[model samples]
Target: MRAAVFVFKRFCGSSFRLQNRGVCDVAVVGGGIVGLSSARELIIRHPNLSFTLLEKENELALHQSGHNSGVIHSGIYYTPGSLKAQLCVKGASLAYKYCDDKGIPYKRCGKLIVAVEREEISRLKALYERGLQNNVKDLSLIDARGIREREPYCRGIMALDSPYTGIVDWCLVALTYAKDFQNAGGSIVTGFEASDISMATESPAGEPEGLKYPVIIRNTKGEEVRCRYVLTCGGLYSDRLSAISGCSTEPRIVPFRGDYLVLKPEKSYLIKGNIYPVPDPRFPFLGVHFTPRIDGSVWLGPNAVLAFKREGYNLFDFNAKDFTDALLFRGLQKLVLKNLLYGISEMYRGVFLGAQVKILQKYIPELGRSDIMRGPSGVRAQALDSGGNLVDDFVFDGGVGELGGRVLHVRNAPSPAATSSLAIAEMIADELEVRFNL
Candidate 1:
């Protein structure tokens, strides 16, 4: 074991030496931060348990987790006592500590939620109160002058100074988790795409039912491998995966692409910290704002525009089927009609970069069209309900007694999910333990 470890270390650094030491007691599908974090927690809690993490991509955090704004949210925006609030607060603290200990770059840069108009003041105050209830300490209400004091060029009627907010490179964090999971005798297989999941229960005698799924996944090379106890964190395709598991719940995933603009280095000083708008009570997303990344580059944006495809990254990208489904879906129709004005405004702002610049200049008067560079975008996999309302919380549905009843399917996990990754993992691991009696 020592010689093998040494040889492995000589080839691949001591941190990520093991790539395929073989399968284990657990198989985590998806190599995003959430899956990697879950794998790390599972191995740490039960060292005796062997684990395997399968990712369809060549590297982890390649999608939403990596594309995010890198903000270490302070649990300020979420409703108090909700899962988002609870998990975000806990996750933020744990993330900072973990990053610090692991030598990963991070900053408690704090944040400012600004109300630019008189009408936004009430919502700003409500968010402030909610932050307090969520135990976000040191939330100070800052008037326009106060905002200018912190961010000299900023504009706003009032703002909330949340010192608990911060930023970190999520890609780095996910890589660290991969390294740790591998070092702890866990297997991480990249380019392994899970095709289907079969479900069944574990008998009292510890025998897996014949209906039990041995997850069939094809590697990048098209080689198929089977595994027991498949736990999926498939992000955008979660609902589809659940359908494959024979679950009746048909929650449609609507993709909302958030476009960003990174302020040129010269204009980066416009924000002393994170600057946000008082979110509309009707919507879950906190409108576009300034986020000072840990790397010192400031970014503005994330206009929620409907994407024609699930994984559409480019402006011109589209899928005929995806667009047709979205247009036909009752929830999508209702969402558009209910927020027609806001939706129209968002769409107009998205196409005309000059319009977006005006919105930015509301806070940073110095920003010009040339100062904004095209930054990366992230797609939110928002789940729509039968009632045509957007599902706000994380949604999970396991086929109870359907596939002999052993599969737990997570249909929706968005937003603070990246923040609540560790806690979410604990939840997944606990449920799996009971299901498999391991």
Candidate 2:
């Protein structure tokens, strides 16, 4: 009671830390959109509790969050009744509002998923039904005339018009969340790569309560934070992080590289908003698409190819361990066998720019090889199970023993994670409350 009084007197109206052991209430690992949003949600919900955010990089949102093509998804692509479907729709609305409130600019230029061939019409119609079932706002099935009206140069037999889709810089949005968390008295420690999580062994002197900080998280630098609970959002290294917590590592993170091509400034006007292909249902990836960024740059492509390194963005970037891990994974082997032809083609397109352009010209006949140049690329932290199924939904887990009761792991948050970050945060916070009894 005496310590409580002193603690209140010392740091009133701010986040609280255990007086003797310097233990925080919660420690959030990773500084991407989900991590920042979750940290912000925690502080907002539990203002008196101390929260700390740790990032491996020197700055926040430098990897996936920063490299993505700035499209605010409209929930049209996700399956009905899935978390991605519900959260994406709700999160897009929340994102727009948050951007509005924060004065972060974004453009709601809309999107069109076009079907060029007759065979694709059935798939396009099925997709429309799926979008309607998912409650995607203002989604409509349009004919060839409508496609031409929306995209003057685009040729298609049918299209799904998603007017709610937009573009925003995700890196900017993530940084805003970071700001909100900090303003609410949350602590952020960049360059702290978390390497271990274990039950705390030490207690504060004269503390009546034993093991106040029951969890200790150590970084690669040997620095540590003592906290009562922990939440991890390790995007690319999520499986490794889970293993360190004594959890199953069956669903490993496999990196996929997506390369984009930027349109010449003079030709950028030819493509407005987003023009996407009717994706193959068997695959987890959306094929090459045209997207206009918030920065006024029009990008084409993002062909999916296996990356040698988990975080590698360039074609030649390689990590021996990463390559070995991916090459030996049973799930990857199965997936490769099933999609060998597609994989070979993707690899071919990666080397030859003209092959990709040839596909692009199918939609926009005026697009020439010289109208585009090599642009930025991004690496997707795709999770795969032993059964060779690509995880397309949120996957959460915890440690195996005592550590399990104290920590929660966000193992996989698939695409549209950025669009659904706020909603994802809300869902995660609910789980945190139940799992950690916060």
Single out the weakest 10-residue window by summed lDDT for candidate 1: 1-10
Clashes of each: 0, 0
For model 2, state the Cα shift of residue 67 in Å. 0.9
lDDT of 1 by residue, 1-438 (tens): 011121122111223433543334567878788888888888888898777887776567778887889888888877787887888888888888888899888888888888888998888888889888999868999888998888888888899999888888887887788788888888877656777665323322333554333444344354544455667778887777677777754688888888898889987767778888788878646778998888799888978889988888777789998778778988888888888888888888888889889988887888899988888888888899766788877776774444323456667776877777877777777877787776
Say which candidate scores most in lDDT. Answer: 2
Model 2 agreement with the true structure over 337-393: per-residue lDDT tens digits:
988989999989988999999999999999999899999999999999887789888
Q: After superposition, how far is residue 176 of candidate 2 from its true place, in Å?
A: 0.3
- The lDDT for every candidate, in the order shown, is 0.76, 0.88
TM-score of each: 0.89, 0.94
Q: After superposition, how far is residue 342 of candidate 2 from its true place, in Å?
A: 0.4
Candidate 1: which stretches are off by over 4 Å?
1-23, 199-222, 400-405
| Residue 156 C-alpha lDDT in model 1 | 86
